[model samples]
Target: MRSPLRSRLVLLSTCALLLATLSGCDDDSGPTPDAGSQLPEDSGTPDSGAPDASTDSGIPDSGAPDASTDSGTPDSGAPDASTEEPWDGGYTVLEEHGDWIDRGRYAPCSFNRQGDPSTVRCDDLSRYDLSQCSPEALAQLDAYGIYMTDLRGEVPRSDGGTGLLPAFAGFMLHSDGGTDTMNTAPLDFRNTDGGTFFIGSSRTNPITGTTLTALAGCQVPSPGIITGCYARCINGSFNRAGTFEAHRMPSHRGESESSGGLRLISESPVAVGEAVDVYVTKNHAYVVSLDRISGTSGGLTVFDVSDRAHPLFKASISLPGDSSWNGVWAKGDALYIAGNDTGTLIYDISNPAQPEYVRHLPAGQFGVHTVLVDGNRLYGMSPDMVTLVYDVTSPLAPVLLQRITVPEELSSGGAHDAFPYEGRLYVSNGFGGYSVMDVTDLDNVRHLGQYVHGSFAHHSAVGTFAGRTIAFEGTEFNGSHLRVLDVTDPTNIVKIGEFRLSPVNSIHNLILKGNHLYAAWYQEGVRVLDVSNPTKPRQVAHYTTFRDGDPGRRGILFEGTFGIRVPGDGHVYVADSVRGLLILNEL
Candidate 1:
């Protein structure tokens, strides 16, 4: 069960809901609150009691060219063909490097020598040398699009030491010349200002009652790439100063919305709060949602997806006072839901379209954020930094096996999610880093080793490629991309390759099907990469599911694809934040 202290921390973290300017709870924190208008679960009724059949969601389309019109070939930017043989256990270990773009030195400016928010002040030009800033390039920026930025820099700590700071920001430049940011309320751009190629935004932290401000004196280092110095102040005191790189997220490398035959089949809206994750089983799609930051409720929304192109709404269920359902999965006749207020909620889905509620596991105030089913074993990751193992040999009834906790859980974050491959379990242990555990015997689970990347380890997909055990790991933060690690030797895991989109967005979940890696990238949309070579991942196909004006679009970094499932049924099931369940044709 979730402790009272952890529950309080969860509430306090939600106070700062802006993903761009403020950090929120980690993956284990359960359903995150979104900054959007509150609507009843039953609002915006679908057509004929089912999702609208239109491929378009009534909002503006992403304007990406149709992939069907492609010439049936990989993009020119794809990696060249390689004839390397399968891994024979001997290979070069690639060293990782910082993702920041360094542009020489900057003129330093002092803030409140004393740690006082009331003494914060903005030093726009004096803080950074702007002689290299190109107003012309900034002016050429797309007047109407969203720019997501990833920032990394150093700040003076109270202990007389320098600390590294990583942050994210989002800017929406309207076609009408007005600008907006995720730091402010949705559609409210009044607190933002920009001239030429520079942009700045300021807001008061309602939770802490402190003044927060940021200024970006930028230079267009390249097309679609904005890099420069930025200063942030809180409560009239200098909080941190850093270098930033912003990427225009609408399109990638001039590619259209889709490529390599991947195309959208249907888009269904979820009227129950903000849709985050989905599970497709027994010819039915089960989507779970979370309450928005506006204090709305979220629950389960079911659909009859027997028809790939048109999904019929079957049922919507929200508990009276506990409605935050973040993850969903099904096995046999059993359906499992990760509930914030409750543990794993079991349901009998023998009827497929109509599910019957069973009982909650470990009853009481247990917080299960995400769940995984491997054979007859069920893994429920809790925000309390513990992974609860269950014997689900009888799918309908689960028996608690044991609680697995890693040393990093307490100091880092908690158990966010896990992937069970072979006799090993790859755990995305929040800030605790990626942990590889020998779980062949749950009774004597042994810690293999851990890869402590300084990013928020969120989700991963592992597979055997060319006789090598490769894991595609991803973090959840601005500028967070995909890291390809060779984990065959868990103790000596090494990063062999990496794949990235815009730094402003984030990679959420990964699904490895054969040699293809399907990812639910938040703002960059659904990305399909060919990882046949593992080290050199190539984008073989993509489908953009995010549009600026989509319904439920909020001023939060996690505003696009959240959950994805490729069931080998020639269809891809996606749970998008705004558009709900998106059915796409598999490549």
Candidate 2:
């Protein structure tokens, strides 16, 4: 038997080789941001922070087409699936800079940062539901610079961290912990009369004057619907964030969990549910797929998996009115989750199977994205892109202690994932990269430093065990790579090394198991690495869960893959575009 140290080394070596092979994939460019109602007519009003009355909805306006989404052909652009000059081509724009730069067309959409302007063409915004099209319509939702709208198109499943949800036309698929697609529901972008859930550029934009080609040219979707996905596509600019069309989840009747087989599952659309997240105990694992129905309390599902090969249906718990949700963490007797719209929710999951709501703390923004509980306080990032600090000492009624606005220039008002270590908070500033802030003064978390070049840095994990901090910044469009920084001294941060694997450009979530770091490589797959040396990171073992071969019989169809940690377990939970939830052991 190999010693623990040798085992870790071997793991690192395997992960390195796999990462090397996958480092060649990609996120869509974020839309122009900050063009909120308060800003001047031309000045973009991106509201990545505190959504106020201005978060109201409005009729789609026709300014210079949404950035690079348009070609030089102006509003009367072509209507083909493929373009002759690449639609928005010739210009070095963000397309050339890879994920490092967010290139746009003329006027550069709303926020207008990328220097490249559309020659004259325009973007297609027809597929997104007018209601859900505003803020997120043009915004890049994931860390890998992947536009949330990307989900609007295809759902291609592959391996590593990216795979199709375990489903078959409105049905949830269930399996053991090996299921990486803990996907609750499909993005449901098919607002059309009777079209498929997936949207396509084949459709034409009736309003933008630009054709389908014009939209895809700039890497955007064709004009359409996004009831639950439209207008809310920018920072602080939420004209609409998508309508909540409650649909009863089709009841799934199949073999009981006692049978070692996979099943399809889904959240009841009409019923409110608790926040969605994953948690772990010494050797056990569980996923909390919560729901915050529009106007009702939420619910949760507890999957008991003492047997890695088989997860038993433990218990189901309900919480206060539909409290929207996100990231989840569990302490002694309580499970804490960032309830997107409901604030922070705490539940008693000591029973492993059955869980009960213990406490909750409302948040500033309507939804909470990422969260971290340090000592007695819980730190949450609201969808409005603000940091909300809560006092969790009183678990029942957690007090809202403070909320801080990230530096405008540094964070796009969007805070995705964050971790507090050594008197400081390290936040993944969405498209803004990784930021180190001094949260010692909770009320006033000072910006200690930042790593700005990583583009759409979605999630980060600090190697506290090794006294080192590492940022797994996601890069789409080929610029995606792992940026390792030396944060021993938060004030003076530096990028010591960047690990890249071809064919696998985008990286989502990562966790350090023992001395080896396992990462979810978007299209590439799951990667294990050796972080023995913080400054110099290396790869080890890699399992292409969804590669063409379909070795393990797990879902191989990969969509935009995202990743996360499974609490105390040595395994990691990777979220595939359509896959339900993937549970990978730390072997």
Query: Best candidate, TM-score-wise?
Result: 1
Q: What does the lDDT come to for candidate 2? A: 0.39
Residue 266, model 2: Cα distance from true site in angstroms: 19
- In model 2, which range of ten residues has the least summed lDDT? 36-45
For model 1, residues 398-478, the per-residue Cα lDDT tens digits are 999988877654325567788887788888886678998888988899899898776667888776665667778887655
Q: What lDDT does each candidate get?
A: 0.64, 0.39
Stretches of candidate 1 off by over 4 Å are 1-90, 98-120, 123-132, 136-144, 154-164, 173-179, 184-209, 216-218, 221-229, 251-253, 363-366, 408-411
* TM-scores for the candidates: 0.79, 0.52
lDDT of 1 at 565: 75
Cα RMSD for candidates in order = 9.1, 20.5
Clash numbers, per candidate: 7, 134
